[model samples]
Target: MTANEMTGGEALAHMLLAHEAGPIFGMGGFQLLPFYDAARRLGLQHHLINDERCGAFAADAYAKVTGRVGLCDATLGPGATNLVTALVESLNAGIPIVALVGNTHRLHSWKNMTQESRQVEILRPAVKEIIRIDHIERIPELIRRAFVVATTGRPGPVVVDIPEDIAHATYPFDETWFEVDSTYTAAPALRTRPAAENLAAAVELLVEAERPIMLCGGGVHISGAAQMITRFAEAINMPVAHTMSGKGSIACTSALNAGIFGRYDRIANRLIDESDVLLVVGCKLGEIATKRYTLPEPGKKIIHLDIVAEEIGRTVIPSVSLWSDAREGIADLLEVLPQDELKERLAKWAATVATRMQQWRVDVAPRLTSAEVPINMARLLHELNLNLP
Candidate 1:
């Protein structure tokens, strides 16, 4: 044991710091006061929102912006229940969040204790994992597991429900207890490269493709593959269309960026509709994005890349499934292609799409400026987002 015995609450704080998971967004309650004190003492910053809902939203946004696990903590009962909305949003979006929720004491479980409720069942539907710490000594390992489970693989929220008694209880501070296998966080997802045969086949499809398109989703950002995606797209001069969730991954100013996809964006939808071959990377190709599974021109060669193997085949079966992270999988395919092979044949095809887009913009130009009271909904958004960094 290298340090003095510490409260389980302190151990939670230390472990969160070690995993680089915090700047907790939450509110304190009676049962979790000990945890708040410990967190403050350990220099873990807390952004105390007035409401638990706000805290959840803040934490979710923090995770998206910082590209790390977002953390939210709250005491028992009402606080945990209040966090459900934020939890579901992240669950569907595939964002990573670690929720630290206080629970009633083990002894008080069946009894009508103050603000007692089943925290696990409530959090289960929303999170990938739900852990209950009955023993204070288990805090170190459980806390470590929470971060990894939340951030690894498909990446979703996790809930750690600590009983008040355990949080306030003391545990022997062994340095060994602090041991957490942090490989999931320290290393990028690109480490899980797809097999060589799969890579070669996917590359051949793209190389033979006369009109190819790259469909990026939030996973592109999650895998930190945005820059690589851009470089590869530019190398092949392939037009790219991304889901709204992946907007920031590529600069809108890029010539090949077709902008946000789905029903509302005609240019993006048209490019996908017109493609001879499609490379789907880090995207679910959900109903909203695919417009009820009608796009991609049915049976066109689809090369899909994703972290979850199950996700690869569930909806749209890929001609070549590179069941790997976006960065590594894309990097593999990029490697097989001849270097500096700009899309010479694709230049005219790209120009055709560009010409159509230009004409549409010209047609809509007056409608955007027609002195309407609402100030042209489309123009307002376009002007507002212009020059945005």
Candidate 2:
């Protein structure tokens, strides 16, 4: 078919299907009929939602589960406006999505024109990118760019405004136009290891510390280094305390799990104050994580490891700052350490942590007994561990 023969809606459907977007979520309207028809013809599943808001939400949920660009579509004017709230939700939640909003014809572009709406302007601030396809020929490029922006960096939503008149207008189909890859492919910066001298110095401090604590954060999850952190903690026999966001990073049921550190947990706060060495991995000591920037005592030693250089010493200046990926850094450190001494230290630390945990259970047992509703913290932890992999 010639470039001028295919309708704008048909071009949109072809572009989306070419990109392998399985199904798009939206409530179809009169302005969106052409696009829906094209979608049906292409065998692309259309999730017919009761409302635009629900459709947008479904797209967001889909993105979160699949880790791919979620797609949503809506008609012009009120239909497009109804999706704003959901778009904002997706933006805040860090979901990758592309919202296809239909617009009025070019003749209705003037202000105060009936059913005229600046859909791009309304969605620009919230979405990562906004593309208004005034020309049908630009559909391929526009769709490609939309997917690129939505899935790159800190992924978020993007909007493609398709005017009704343009949707119905003819354009030639060209399969080759949509063949190029527009996805962001750059890998995350790898974590670098500390120098030999620096590693020796850190080990010296760790070896002499009487009471050491390992503080793990959400960075472990982001860096996919949770296993390394757990292994390193076990190797050094260190008690593992996590930030709110870092809760699931370590197996919560492990004897080494010292619980969360914050205003909400007084025991954890006391433990942090008592510790001599704090090994922070993949976690920035942000205001919330550090309880309003209050840190361990001055005499305490802090070793910080994170992927981003700037995040290394942000909250509390570390005695040793290692700008590296948490997982690899910890594994490398463990590999270089004296295996016998490390195992000995780990056993000692695990024993101490267990003793402390027993004491805590005894202290809280009286409260549990007095409460009208019996609560077993240990049972709850056991159940959760059993259910989770």
Candidate with the greatest TM-score versus the true structure: 1
Q: What tens-digit string does per-residue lDDT give for candidate 1 at 1-389? A: 47668887888887887776557999998677778898888788998889998998898888877767888988888999889999999888777888999988787786999888876788789778898888888788888787778777878888999888888888788877776665644324224789889888988888788888888998888888899998888777788888888775567777777877875575888777778888898998888778887766667789989888888867788899898988888888887787455478677666665676677778887865567886888778667666476
Query: Please, what are the lDDT tens digits per residue for candidate 2 over residues 184-293?
Result: 31112234666677677677777777677888876665455678777777766778888876776678778788888764553566678878878888677777667787
Q: State candidate 2's TM-score.
A: 0.70
Regions of model 2 farther than 4 Å from truth: 1-5, 76-89, 113-122, 131-134, 180-239, 243-245, 274-287, 295-389
TM-score of each: 0.94, 0.70
RMSD of each: 2.0, 5.2
- Consecutive 10-residue window with the lowest summed lDDT within model 2: 182-191
Which candidate should be chosen as best, given lDDT against the real structure? 1
For model 1, give the 10-residue run with minimal summed lDDT.
182-191
Per-model lDDT = 0.81, 0.74
